[model samples]
Target: MQTFFIGFFGLAAVVFAVGVFRTSSMMRSALALLFSQTALGALFLAMQAEFLGVLQIMMMATEMSIMAIFMVMFMMDPGGLGGMDMSHQKRLSLLAGLGGVVLVTGIAAYTQWEGLASATEAAAADEQIRQLGRELLGRSMLVFETAGITILTAMIAATAVAVKVPEQGGSHES
Candidate 1:
């Protein structure tokens, strides 16, 4: 059953990756990214890392959804089905693709070589959860709060930059 769940998660991850790469619409890409993160969280749960799994779901899934909603609200075409302005920056796109391929390959090689010996270690759920909560609040609390603040600031800045304000002066003043 565990193997089956893991395999399912792997398949879902692959599908999500394909969607991310192939979809042109920003909304579709965001959905695909969400699916991929969910699959990753499931994989963590399957490995008995319950705390990490929950954190992944809470932070990635929920947070990403909110981010996507903000993006949709601010974007010129929220649905992202409209034609895009891609007339320029072909070279930049090609360079980015090449960089992404290299990074993916590097990650694949590292994971394959490092293996998963430690990932298979088992522990009681209660203990694991306790340790995770302690570490999160004790050591990583500041980092987590800082990240939240950063996200909030970015959202505010984006909204302010995107919104257009009208002048208060009357036309007769000209």
Candidate 2:
């Protein structure tokens, strides 16, 4: 059952990832992205990483909701009005994607995976998660905080730029 669900979610993620790019409407694309992220989270849960999986799903839900709201509010045709075309430089993009796949495959085929063999013992799931939390929040706290602040700053700047300021004497609302 677990194996089946893992495979299902993996396949769903791939399909939805494609949908993210192929959908004409911004809202549809955002939904696709949300679904793809959720599918990936399920995949992680199937692999027994509960914390990361749940966090991924929750984060993506909030992010996608905000994204869809922004798209609807700011975009001229959030629904793609009349089937807006989305792709650009298709041939080059396809070639680049194929090249990336080939490169990654070659690397995976040649690499020696020894980390699993070096496990100290059969550690419990929760302990492993704790170690991950320590690694992220302890050793990498600065890096994580920097990334969070950077993203927040960017969002603030983008909102400021997108917002329409009413002129002093003019009534902006018609």
Best by TM-score: 2
What shift in Å separates residue 63 of candidate 2 from its native position after superposition? 0.5
Best candidate per lDDT, number?
2
Question: What do the candidate models score in CA lDDT, each in turn?
Answer: 0.82, 0.90
Query: After superposing candidate 1, which stretches have Cα over 4 Å from the reference?
Result: 1-4, 85-120, 133-174
lDDT of 1 by residue, 9-97 (tens): 97898789778756556677788988899899999898788888888988888877887898788788756577565346878987997
Cα lDDT of model 2 by residue, 121-159, tens digit: 435679978888898899999998999999999999999
TM-scores vs. true structure, each candidate? 0.60, 0.75
Task: Assess the local accuracy of residue 104 in candidate 2 as a C-alpha lDDT between 0 and 100.
Answer: 100
Clashing pairs in 2: none
For candidate 2, what is the TM-score? 0.75
